[model samples]
Each structure stands twice: as structure tokens, then as C-alpha cells.
Target: MSLKPNIVLVAALALSVAGCGKKEVDTLPPAPGPAPIQSQNQGSQTRIVPGSQADFSNRMAGLDTIYFDTDQFDIDDEDAVALRRQAEWLRQYPAKRARIEGYTDERGTREYNLALGERRATAARNYLVSLGIAENRLTVISYGKERPAVLDSTEAAWARNRRAVTLTID
Candidate 1:
């Protein structure tokens, strides 16, 4: 065979091999489609912002804020119902932790309110623990009368202020 023709054949063979490799790379199966939405969200899907206060509030709805009787740190039957609902929600998100913030009305002294608030928070934490929630996932803090839900000095406002608000934390 002529040297010139042999060289040309070799070059053509090399180019064909390169082209085959490119085709193989391009022919990979199409990337999998996005994962299917969970069956529970059959209609409209609502996106949840995990560990956000807004997310917690949205998921928890009316149960996030549990009101207490004046000068009381114990959880009442009504409060227990709300706490149960909250515990259910918390159980849904195992990765999430909760901060139980206790507050009191403006009637008590600051120090007394602080102590009462701590007791209230602890009370809520204990209730949640009793409801099968892990003790480690819950924390307690007392804001005393400092952070009032309602600013007015009415019975309604005080009633609203004396509460243990459960908030989701990262």
C-alpha cells in the first residue's frame, strides 16, 4: 500500500473513533424528572419553610399560642388540648426543635413574673414530653411581663399576654 493512502486511512479511523466516543457521551439517558409530589398534597401543594416562625405558625395555626390562667404555671385542660395538637405537629417534623417562651401579665413584680414565666415554660415543656415528644427537642425560656401580646391594660389583653408561646427553632 502507498504510504500516503495508509496515513490517510489511519487519520480517518482516529476521527471515526473520536466521533463514536462523542455520540456515546451524548446518548446518555435523559436525567430523571423531578421527584413526584407526596400523595397527601393531591390538590394544591403548599411549600413549608422548615424551622421558620412563619412555618410553625402556619402549620400550628391556633394551637401555637397557649393561654394560661392568671398567676398560674400549670397547664389546664384547655391548654392540654392545644399542647396535644402542638405535640402532633412537632412529631411530624422530627428535625425541628421548639423554644417554649413563657410570659405573664403586667400585674406581678418583674422578678416574680420572671419566675412564674419560667415555671409556665417548664410546665409546657413537661406536658410536651409527656405527649411522647423528646425532652431534648424542647427548650424553655421566660420573658416575664416584658413581651406582651397585647399592649392595652385590659383583662382581655392580660389574658392574651399570660401565655406560653411555642416557637419552632432551627
Candidate 2:
């Protein structure tokens, strides 16, 4: 009889001790923490320049630029077709944005080069806008003589450098 009582007491004590050691896990607090905001110009996600064959083939396909005479920002009749094609693409992809990067040959002072480059980019941008693209969707930057597509100091090289490039951005 004494053994039965003692066994019951021992089982009760074991159950009480096991219950004291257990705790309910918490899961709700960490999920409510704020997420970090990403900057607009974060480079990893920026679109690549469209001059490469793969990029050009995918986005511009048959479109190509018509070269300008030295120190000119005016888009001649030959250039209009290419600009129209670009505007069409922009219209088709309304969410897409582009940056117009302008460059110049190493013939002028740094400030002059910068200004000329800006004019070139602006002219191209304005042409696109005239074709019905939104001005807000485009950005213009002048690289001046800082970045050259062709590094040689030759006329052909200068001709290549004195151009504007379009880069798509998401």
C-alpha cells in the first residue's frame, strides 16, 4: 500500500518537473522589422549600354546611327529615321527608361567638350521627344573627352568618340 502511494507521488513530481522545463517558442517579433530601401542609382541592377552586339540585337535590332559633321548637334534627315525607330521602341516599352550619354573628341578644352557633349545628348533627346517620347523618361549626361569609344588620336577615332550612346535602365 505504501509503495503504491510513493509511486504515485514520484510520477506526479516527474510530471511537474517536465512541465517547468518547457517554454513556448516566440515567432512574431522579428517579422515586423523594417526593410532597407534601395537607392535608384544602385549599379548592380542598372541596364548595360546598348552598343554591344547582344544588347543592340535584343533592343535596337536593325536601328543604327547616322554620323554627324564635326561640332554639330543638329539631327539631319539621315539621323531622323534612327531616332524615330528609338522612339517607337520607347513607345512599345513604356516602363523602360534611357540615359543619353554624350561624348566628344579630344579637340577642345575640357569645359568646351563638356558643353558640346551636352548639346549633342540634348539634341538627340529632343529629337526623341519630338517623336513622342516623354522627356521625363530620358536622362542626359556628358562624358566630354573623358571616355572614348576609340582611344587612338586619329580622325576615325575622333569620329567614333564624338557620338551619343543610349543605355536602357529598368
Score candidate 1 by lDDT: 0.87
lDDT per residue as tens, model 1, 1-170? 57999999999999998877533465678787654322234366645455566666876778898888889888888899989988888888888899999999999799999999999999999999999999999999999999998999999999999999998887
Candidate 2 lDDT: 0.77
Clashes of 1: 0
Question: CA lDDT of each candidate?
Answer: 0.87, 0.77
Clashing pairs in 2: none
What lDDT score is found at residue 142 in candidate 2?
A: 92
- lDDT of residue 61 for candidate 2: 56
The TM-score of predicted model 1 comes to: 0.70
